[model samples]
Target: MVFDDKNADQAQSLREKMSGVRNGLKVITLASGKGGVGKSSITVNLAIALAQLGIRVLVMDADFGLANIDVMLGVQTKHNLTHFLRGERRLDEIVHIGYDGVRFISGGSGMMELLRMNEGQLSKVMHGLTKLDMPIDYILCDAGAGINDNLISMILASSETIIVTTTEPTAILDAYALIKTIVKRDNLHPLHVIMNRAESKKEADHVLDGFSEVLAKHLQKEVNRLGHITLDPEVPRSIKRQTPIMISAPNTSFARDIRSIARELLELPPQKEPGNVFSRLFSGLRK
Candidate 1:
């Protein structure tokens, strides 16, 4: 909420001096209450879009159950978060390059493994992250779908969370449930939404009207609707080709929607990234 220390400003300035790093390492998680809503796909392309804008970005596949981000990007990973947890690799070693110069880490398939991590290991991991030669501007975490202790903690610790959902009745209901749970825990949490796989802007807005109404009346929270992504034939094809839309089909409507979202995100006021990330993460479980 305030300057962490006197050197906070100086440290931030130094990070900006890096090749193309943005001012702060803004942490964002793109999540959905149900899978198959295209959450990971949006995360992958969104990170690349930000990178294309000259921002040093790192997208983490925080699912902890699936490692599809790499598969979608058509890249293989020699190391992941599991290796770091087992003391087999450093944090930086787990990061791999993706399209448009974006960086990424694949979260291994064991969410609970993090709780067993000790303070010493946590310190080492933190050092590994903060000491990167080229600092990161944003850490976009593709948090796994569904509600759980780990997911809630991740959403709480992030600077902002974009809930990706479709216009399907079930998808909308699940998204509302997710929002209710999050607001129940922290009503003041900053929330946003991305309408994906929509038929048109009219349909997306029709859904938002009822959705945001429920939040304002019952939960007392208003969410920002970033924009909607039209159902483009190019999306599935791009996925099959293992190329991000931003690179393969930049002229498609899908890529245009992503670029618009990236611009909207960049305009947000930067949040202060505190030191000792793991401490803040595990501490949430204690509450």
Candidate 2:
């Protein structure tokens, strides 16, 4: 197969941008204490929102056995991490372009071998990721729900983590559990809390206040509130239709909430000096 010269030029330009990535890449691991809390939905939408702000964004559907970013966007995957792990594909080969200019790497399901990869394989995987030719401003890792070695590694490797939860008691408790675990592992890692499916701002404020209070007293770590998403009927509809809410119903309240969250993240101060490059960060974690 022959490649287009113009495309190659553009690829070269992207690589140049990568080299000059001064502030580094912002890697955020979007995680939850449990499943079914709209974590994946938030991940996909937030990615699009960030991209819409003119920030080149990449989403790593790192949910492993339960990846859903591709399914949620209706993007068919010919090759995912499974093929890459087996040396059948490269990192760029497995990346899928999703709606609103968001690029993502899908995590194919039921690959027990992937979950149990040895050190050599792990090193290869990390090497592939750190060598991407495309330049990106943000990488949102939609990590699998709950705690595990992989999940812990991913979060610990990231510059920041967003803990998504709902107003439900179980969800809140589970969010706290995940936060406690992370704090126990690394207290200096910046943690952001996002309350999803909130019925009212009052409800969200109350829950977040109580949750933050408890976390401060127990973990002695202050959590940043990254805004909240309201319960919108159209969110599920958009998901069922394989479109992001930001696209299908851009005027909806849910879409606005996501955009707001994206803006808040963009307004955040960048890390000084070398920035947070995924390749550097993940490699250090492995060591």
Instruction: List clash counts for every candidate, in order.
Output: 0, 0
- Report the C-alpha lDDT of model 2 over 1-287, residue by residue, as the tens digit: 12245333433333343333436777788999778888899999999988888888889888776677888898789898889888889889998787878899988877777667553454455445556788777888888877665566567656789999999999999888888777766688799999999999899999999999999999999988998999999988988999998888887889888888887887754322233488689979999
The Cα error of candidate 1 at residue 136, in Å, is: 0.9
> Which candidate tops lDDT?
2
Tens-place lDDT per residue, model 1, 212-265, is 898789888999988889898998998899888888988788988888888888
Cα lDDT listed for each candidate: 0.75, 0.79
Return the TM-score for each candidate structure: 0.79, 0.83
True-structure lDDT of candidate 2: 0.79
Candidate number of the best TM-score: 2
RMSD of every candidate to native, in Å, equals 14.4, 14.7
Q: Pairing residues by index, what is the TM-score of model 2? A: 0.83
